[model samples]
Target: MSHYKSNLRDLEFNLFEVFGADRAFGQAPFDGIDAETARDVLAEVNRLAREDLAASYTEADRNPPRFDPVTNTADLPEAFKKSYAAFMASEFWRLDLPESLGGTLAPRALWWAIAEQILGSNAPVWMYSSGPSFAHVVQVEGTEEQKRWARLF
Candidate 1:
């Protein structure tokens, strides 16, 4: 019942072989995460996406979400919410985000590579996963004082 499929082989190829990400790891920012850890993270994320995300996909499509004009909100099905929570529990959204925001900083290309795989499995979940990432970017680009505000946010 799972339509979600990921190409982990190609992802690893792009990360280690094609991009030479191994050279960037074991250094500042990425000091703790090397190529192996990155691959493991990717594999785990792929599994969560394929199993949990994929399972909820069809149920959500069948039930769908309802927009409440009165409340100016869209009510999501419990099944869809369950899928979102599963992805969140995976904590893979933290990749590429700053450690301050609970993310392990990795190469941008590597980050996007794994992220794209999850997105392909379920785009709506990935779309909502951008909040902390946006905040992290603000923290990095913001002034010193603004950094505190970003963290608070």
Candidate 2:
């Protein structure tokens, strides 16, 4: 056995079997998209995570990041910055948000499936990217202008 094993089989089993969360997308916003399309989005996001975001995580851990006391800025390694850009570019940041706010409202299970891959790769990175969903929740509970600001964030 190798240390680099991915739990893709488990992901598949969870998505298609076990919890049976695949049926939630049959109405309203999700009705326009099928399960296969959802799977494609997940696959593409995971590919980007492995090839781009996770590329520098080990090196980042080795070097860590240095902070400038004056500027109050953490000067992350170039590798980590590149990885962060790649992760952001995946648009994984916008999952589970309302379309009005430039997001695709996906099935919760599919959302969790993608989350597992991101979290497995780097938990902090996953949390950072999940801000949009949090913002969406806030928007729902906020006033109109506040909702606008949430979307902007």
Candidate 3:
């Protein structure tokens, strides 16, 4: 039974004490949101990641996915599939996305707080799901449609 350690205390400190993100989230896009909501979100993410998500890691590794040359697709072990199915069932990816994109309007700093847990656990998994973070960058640099695609595509 392996466990991953996340620097949640540091994240909280940065959010509330250091960077004062709590205050920032209280205005504009985060006007209605508060530090308590951020803490609740973090706690939930931590519990899910530690309980449900971590349960899949060892099983998936012991039985890694295999690529099918004929089908041009990979076939993961049944165990891995089942485990990942449960993982996706958690809807971890949809945590802080835009409501239009089926996500809640959580502050970016809060998202970072959640990310630290997932990243600390399986860095590659975190790396693979960089769409939201990258989309933020692209939206800043890209045209209006491109920004729209950040949510659409």
Candidate 4:
């Protein structure tokens, strides 16, 4: 069994009921995703978090990443790498990115809702897989040349 436990019900309540994220979907920049799609995304991510991602939590904690002074790099545990790869394969990280970057223009509320699950499941996985979001920042704030470079990330 996995060590991480998520309250998906409470998350949905906050996102749909209190925050009204459903109202934001299917509108304006978020037209690509509707309420039903958003819910599906949440459900899928929840399963991934509880099953695949959470599978590595205890193993990773027991065998943390190793830093090599000579190589100037840190080598993550194999289990952690597997979990991170699973998340990247899901491609949900693209939700908040711009259309030009092959991402859906999702609402911040929905993004945070998704983030909560990933972070809660395995924070290291979320941290290591932040390249897409960083690329998004560079795409938005960087110069034209920099924007081109950000696409490679």
Candidate 5:
């Protein structure tokens, strides 16, 4: 059984009530996404975190990754790989990215809220999936040449 538990109500309260994420949505940059859509996104991510992502949390902890000194690499457990693949396939990570990178313009609050669900379920999933966020940073702050390289991520 998974040990992870998500407090989606609390998250929604903070985002919609306290932070006024609804006001931010359907506005500049977040034009396409509205309050309803944000709520749906949160619900979906919460479900995913509780089910797919949390499925392998304990197994991964028990098995861990096997490091190869000679090859300088590690082999992740199959269970963890499946969970990682599920998260990648969800494409929710694209919410915070720019439209140029095939992502919608989401508020930072929304992105962090999404992050909390994933992180609370399985930390390694969030940690391993930092490539897109890192790429976004590079695309924004890097020179033209470096920006091109960031797209590969």
Candidate 6:
């Protein structure tokens, strides 16, 4: 844990000062989401990454996913599961997704910045959680019926 650290300072500075992302607010697609709200979301996601996600890096490595014959699916280690649960509770995955898919529809810069906290905290988590991200993209480019189905993911 001591070796892991998140660059929230640079992130906020880039969003507000260097880039002046605040001006993007109160507009279509990004309406109702001001600078303060975006900052708050970033802060919370960072906290969750540090407190819950980064907390188990070493342990989760030792305990990898295993095969569950009865379920015919891989059972994620309890350590990983714990971290996954923490991430799911935060629901930060919706930050980058479109509003049609029940997401915030935030700016790509801010969305990816916030995502860096979670995915960078645990690389494996990003790989495992690719379903939602993929679903979001498909929902955006896919047909109407396909978008409806992607929502289930």
Model 2 lDDT, residue 55, Cα: 74
| Per-candidate local distance difference test | 0.79, 0.72, 0.67, 0.90, 0.93, 0.79
Candidate 6 clashes between residue pairs 3 or more apart in a chain or in different chains: none
Write the residue-wise lDDT of candidate 2 on 1-153 in tens digits: 111234666876777788765676566767855767776777776676677767776877788778889999887778877877777787766667888778877777777788777776755577656677778887999888888889777
RMSD of each: 2.3, 2.6, 3.5, 1.2, 1.2, 2.1
The 10 consecutive residues of candidate 2 with the worst lDDT sum are 1-10
lDDT of 6 by residue, 1-153 (tens): 433599999998888899888889757768858778888888998888888887767777777778889989986777787888888768877776776677777888787786788777887776666677899877878999988889998
Clashes of each: 0, 0, 0, 0, 0, 0
lDDT of 4 at 78: 86
Where does model 4 exceed 4 Å of error?
Answer: none
True-vs-predicted CA distance for residue 85, candidate 2, Å: 1.4
Worst lDDT 10-window in candidate 6:
94-103
Q: Write the per-residue lDDT of candidate 3 for residues 1-153, one digit (tens) a residue.
A: 646765667878888998888886657776656778778778777776676556666766676667889989976556445544554566656655655556557677877787777765544456546566567656667899888887754
Output the lDDT of residue 7, model 5: 97
Local accuracy of candidate 1 as per-residue lDDT tens digits, 39-139 = 78888888888888877777777876788899999888787798899887777777757777777877787778777777888887887777777788789
If both were scored by lDDT, which would come out higher, candidate 1 or candidate 4? 4
- What is the lDDT ranking, best to worst? 5, 4, 6, 1, 2, 3
Where does candidate 2 clash, by residue pair? none
TM-score each candidate. Answer: 0.85, 0.83, 0.71, 0.94, 0.95, 0.86
Q: Using TM-score as the measure, name the better of candidate 2 and candidate 6.
A: 6
By lDDT, who's the top model here?
5
Q: What TM-score, to 2 decimals, does candidate 6 have?
A: 0.86
* Residue runs of model 3 more than 4 Å from their true location after superposition: 77-87, 127-153
- lDDT score at residue 105, model 2, on the 0-100 scale: 76
lDDT against true structure, model 6: 0.79
